[model samples]
Target: MAPKEKDDKPIKINKWEGAAVKNALDDAVKEVLTKKFNYVENFALMDGRLVICGIAVGVAMFALVWDYLYPFPQSRPILIFSVTTYFIMMGILTLYTTYKEKGIFAVCIQKDSSKKENVWEASSYLPKYDDKYNLILALIDGKTRQRRETSIKKSVANYIDVNGSVVNELVEAEVTKMHNSLLSERKEK
Candidate 1:
């Protein structure tokens, strides 16, 4: 992916820095690793097991073919064991790659619905503290709107520690206004 155009929006820090706040931020970051984002977490344990089983069967068939060609008494068993072990390892690796591909597949599906313009280039925004922080604030706002029972903003407000509630209130209002505008536009269409 190419670098994204720089955002002109000012980077704003609302909270005080502290060990507790850092830990909370770290935890919140980890939340992105779930199926909601990473997608691999949704894989069933059986998928891995099935891959192992398939490998075993394929290795057995290969061993049989090798034995038929060589017809050696001493080398057959050793060859079979080695082939089985090697194939098992390779099979496990292949299965893991498949599992990872599934996650990417999920991401691709969600990518289409994410944003029409694709202005938020995650690659460019991820490394900068300011961009990442603002992105998190936006995510919290959107998530909080989607699930009213769980206030993502309230949960992390202490960590971000914007001086007063005013900053957060402003963010909420903006999110709501944008959401309402989108709804009204859709209704008009």
Candidate 2:
């Protein structure tokens, strides 16, 4: 007897059901926390802002004291220029920070590369309600690394929910149906 060859076809394992879903969701949340809410980056920006503000304050105070002490006519223009430049720089930094943060949140979802046959990619929008996330899950072909299907569940763990929880139910059912439909469509072709 000849040995059987292994199938190279991608397999879809249900990562979005039972306790597994919790783990997947936790991983997604962790990614968001680590990448989007990065403490080090935040601290650095905040420190920069504080330093700029302090410099502005120090300059203003020095100018006030100097003017009161000596009353130089030329000092006012120099003080104004320095203070205005500091404020403008601070504003630019603030705008850049805001744009950077928004960009992070805008593309929060990332691909999952743990498996070789089928991959589960997950993303979420900013929580609209306290402790509730709007999650989007995609099933990707590991070989092609392309998204085959997607499922959106809004307000996970919502009070008086319509969409239902992310765990132990919704995603698996939806994905399975999609998988079956795809299989059937392929067979027909």
Candidate 3:
């Protein structure tokens, strides 16, 4: 359970629960680690596709060995084997050409009624968080944007809009690609 606030004073988070808090923190850390693992897995998948393609070609190219081994001897079996391996390898290697990618995204908006200015910041490209997700940052005006995180001054409110499911693959992509995210804050009027 979430720690309850004391009646008369500000809740002292550390004074109450220790193990519970630690467990919560540990869970959160594990969640993030899982995300990172997903990212690496996607990277590895992309890498593996390339490697498979290479191996397929390597197998087919070795078919030429049949000619060398057949000096004056009729190695019909070798020739047929090499040709079959080459065709099968080429067919399998060609499949890598068709592949797709995806990622997750979050949006944050900040606003203050008193001011006319707003900020659009993404979860990615924040300089401190360029990689690990896909971030698209844009400086927007008073007008609305198609899809973006808007922050107005003073409210200090928080809003998160997460898009897409957890992709346990492309963990190491630029944060903006692996996930789409935005953060913005606004002040109270």
Sort the predicted structures by lDDT, highest score first: 2, 1, 3
Better of 1 and 2 by lDDT: 2
Residues 1-189 of candidate 3 have per-residue lDDT tens digits of: 877654223112231233332232222222333344232112443465577767766665665665666652576666677668777766664554343211112222335364644433222211221212223333334445434442212110111112211222222232333233232221211
Who is ahead in TM-score, 1 or 3?
3
Candidate 3 has its poorest 10 consecutive residues by lDDT at: 152-161
What C-alpha lDDT does candidate 2 achieve relative to the native structure? Answer: 0.46
The clash numbers for all candidates, in the given order, read 3, 0, 35
Candidate 2 structure quality by residue, lDDT tens digits, 1-189:
766653222222243233333344544343343444331112443455567678767767877887777677867776777678778867866775576332122222223355454433344443423344454544445456555544445433431223322332344444345445544543464
Best candidate, TM-score-wise?
2
* 1 versus 2: better TM-score goes to: 2
Give the candidate order by descending TM-score. 2, 3, 1
Top-lDDT structure, candidate number: 2
* TM-score per candidate, chains pooled: 0.23, 0.32, 0.30
Residue 187 error, candidate 1, Å: 1.6
In candidate 1, stretches whose alpha carbon ends up further than 4 angstroms from where it belongs are 1-126, 131-167
Summarize candidate 1's per-residue lDDT along 160-188 as a digit string, tens digits.
Answer: 43542223333444334443454354445
